[model samples]
Target: MKIIAISGGSGSGKTTAAKQLQQFLGNDDCKILSQDNYYHDHSDKFSGDGSVNFDHPDAIDFHLMAQHLKLLSENKAVEVPIYDFVTHTRKKETIPFKPTKFIIVDGILILSQEILRPHFDFAIFIDIAEETRYSRRLKRDVEERGRHPEGVKIQFDSFVKPMHEMFVQPSRVFATHIAYDNNSLANLFEDLKKDFF
Candidate 1:
């Protein structure tokens, strides 16, 4: 099985890239493991004032995610955690993830974590302008995550931008490919298909 890590700043289209790759590879041949699901429960720490830095690597349980990846690499199935973004908590039930030909792991901090980095056979970092990222994040947060516009802006300014600079951007050096936009990602898909498939 090949493990692919897709890392980018929030709203940089990491999830979209992963979905496109999965579709290109076929659903039966690939499975996705989202790092967002591994975020540590922040219910008690939720202040809605951007005090909690969710963008930080410490905010996720990388050890558990690594273990799950290891298990999957060994052709073992695992129960992946289910996180509730609305409540900032983990759900009681988990989703069972089976091994496949390819595993696409998407997140802003996945490449930043040392424990998780070595597991990836291929790593991609998506790069985009701050303005584009912020705009996309704002729309997603307000529309999909039920976040207020004001709070999204505050959190982006306080945590996302700085953390992206500190953690996410530096991790770009580890990527085998860096995509700047949808067109780049599409070209990558063609290249990957030619090289791997």
Candidate 2:
């Protein structure tokens, strides 16, 4: 089995590509794990001041996530944490997953660290313009994620935007393949089909 790491900034459409790749490979043939699922669940510790800095690497339990990936690579069944973005907590349920031919890991900082970087058999980078990313982030956060437009801007300015340069953007240097265009559902499937075979 192969592990394909998809890395990009928020709103880069890497998640769409990962989903399409999974569908093309079929449910039994591939699995996807997202880094957001590793977000630190700190419902009790936070002060409700809206100052949580989630863009940092310390905001995740990468050690636990790395162990799970090792188990999956060994063909062992593992239960994954179901994270709730709205509540900033992991759900009570754990989802079982096993990869058949491949496991697609999608995230903003997949290659940002050397420890997590070497695990991927293939690394794919999704590139987009800053203007495009801001536009997509504004639309998606408000319409889908239920975040306020003003809050999004604030968060982006304070952390998210700067972190791209500090961490995420530099990680692109590690990618084996770089995609400039935002791959559509159909096109993403086709691209996966072309590569997997």
After superposition, the stretches of candidate 2 with alpha carbons farther than 4 Å from their true spots are: 45-50, 183-195
lDDT of 1 by residue, 111-179 (tens): 988899889999999998999999999898888878888889899999999999999999999999999
TM-score, every prediction:
0.97, 0.89
Q: Rate the local accuracy (lDDT) of all candidates.
A: 0.92, 0.80
TM-score of 1: 0.97
Q: Poorest 10 consecutive residues of model 1 by lDDT?
A: 45-54
Question: Best-fitting candidate, measured by lDDT?
Answer: 1
Per-residue lDDT over 23-49 for candidate 2, one digit per residue giving the tens place of the 0 to 100 score: 778878888998888877967654433
